[model samples]
Target: MISVDGLGPTDYERADAARLTRLPQHDLLVMAGARFGDLAPWRHPEYLRAVAGLPEEQALAALFVLGRQVPEGSLPAPLLALLSHAKIVSVGSGLLSADYALVRLEGLTLLAAWRAAGREVGSYAPWVGTDTSTLCRLVAARRTARTALDLGCGTGALAMTAARNGARALAVDINPECLAATTFNAALNGLADRVAVRQADMAALDLGERFDLVISNPPFLPLRRGALGWLAGEGGPDGLDFVWAIVRQLPELLTERGEALVQFASFGDQRGPFCAAQLADELPGLGLSARMLLKPPTPPRWPAFAERDEQGNLAGDLGREYRAYVQSIGATHYHPCVLSLRPGDGGLTIGRYS
Candidate 1:
């Protein structure tokens, strides 16, 4: 749970992100974008300019809270007290300049209290990720399920969204911090009780419960142990390790004619994201039909990915260990994709976003 602030709703500070675009707080929203530039780069410059344009008092408050660099006494008394109560912005060194703040994801403003990527053992990082927006877009557009399951419920985004759309949601995550965030966000978003968080690994899932819909944005990043590794992000040398295991389990966990919507980095022996081909090979075995909703055109080999990402992901140049590992395993490239699964092997719709 996030530390409580005496001056105001710290819960709001922690989890009101998904609600930002819901209300038209344009000025504050713009400032928020500026404050949270690292996560959403496209809007960075404008937000930075907005912050720079702030009056002295307000600017000091922004600086103090955004990063811990400014002394608490530097800010106006009221703002200082409020910002002081929040815990340390314990993100990776590169991101410590900005404190945990709100970020826009599609239409939802989701919270990211710490760095979004990297996996730590004692604590789980806030997982307001790029693929999560994709998962949200696909899941939110579907007809609401009677009972929805968010298997890797990072912040309970999908489960909470599902509840709002008329489903009783069960959010499960192996990480305690993630479950805490999920349950907290559920209450913060007025989804308390409706969307509950469970602590469980997808591998050990044997709940007698079955659901009409199962959604996940599982960790598909293929990283060697050298980097900041999290057990959650490990998808083996092939990276498809978790994806294959999760889909195999889905066949039994679903209600009759039930459905699933999930997103992942799809790879093939031949390199590049072969999301459709991989699913086509497996879904038939489970007597399941699927619709590959959209495939992002730029695979890992593409120019955009060839550049070192701001997060320092292994996209531009896989580190020596990572490169060696993937090569040894004959794993070439991976791409992002969203797939909708159902009980039959018909109506397999696949398309590009455009």
Candidate 2:
């Protein structure tokens, strides 16, 4: 048996050296008469059912996408060599076991360094979640920038996407594993020269340079203290800790005519939106202007805000503690939206998104 560790920059490099990225990538997994996006495929019965047949392609998906054990012959020779050299997958009994998950996004294959479900959020490379994908699409639709910054860059999806669109990118995260994962991804996607990784807390960040575009899908979930399974979701009482930190840095982080795109949830009470209205008062004072592309408000999901056990089981009633904390803070609802900021006279605008 070939023992391997979880993914890191070196693992990605080994894959690249083996020319793994040269292979055709699959973005969708078809199973049980249904097609599914690449969100934790191992948990879905549809994916497990598809993997049972062991078709060459789906078997390949089983190795990388589902992080399941696959037959030795499932992938090409080069991939086999890559897997062995990188020690990212274990080989035993003619089967290979991968501990990471890779998914396609914006024409690039992004890999998430695997950690068990109950691990600390920062201990592994984050998979591209809905907010990350939404922000990536928004950035891709916008004009390309000469330079870009992705704060709290989770697997460097946004930065890699920006590089794919013709920009040199700086991918920042507080987690070393995240930085390593981003580094590996940049090289895997052949964007290493265009993408750089940095480890720094966003609250104390000081790159001393501005970018034409800055993007983030920051942690914005509101939760009670000590109720978080992941450090990324440490949004404090109102879930605006990171949001406020990023907003406070915006005036200094963008060049003239440069824009910062942030995806976050804006809390609201009887008065109005929390961050939205607060920005109206603060952005102008900081010589910045803002526009919020608002989506319909949604109640916070109960499971997301509660703590979980090592086995990934919820520790308490479905968000019972979380909901009480939210009510205590006077926030009745939250709007998921992307806030656009630019250097200009103080002004705040709101627009609806479908």
Instruction: Quickly count the clashes in candidate 1.
Output: 5
Q: Name the best candidate (by TM-score).
A: 2
Q: How close is candidate 1 to the true structure, as a TM-score?
A: 0.70
- The residue ranges of model 2 lying beyond 4 angstroms of the native Cα positions read 1-25, 29-59, 71-81, 84-87, 91-95, 113-124, 224-226, 269-272, 303-305, 308-321
Decoy 2 TM-score against native: 0.80
Q: After TM-score superposition, what is the CA distance of residue 221 in candidate 1 from its true location, in Å?
A: 0.8
Clashes by residue pair, model 1: 17-109, 18-109, 34-47, 66-99, 289-344
Cα lDDT over the full model 2: 0.70
Runs with alpha carbons beyond 4 Å of true place in candidate 1: 1-45, 49-65, 68-99, 106-109, 117-124, 224-227, 269-278, 299-318, 325-333, 347-350
lDDT of 1 by residue, 1-354 (tens): 344324234544453333333432223433343366334332446544555554553333243223334443444444333333444233343332334544445544444544442212123445766567667776777675789999888777888778877899998887766776665566556677688777788867877889998998876666532244464765555456667767878878888878888777655443345556666777778888877655544434321112255666455345555666656645455556677788877746676553
Error of 2 at 58 (Å): 4.7
Q: Write the per-residue lDDT of candidate 2 for residues 112-188, one digit (tens) a residue.
A: 65432222332344656656767888888766598999999888989988888898899998776677667767777
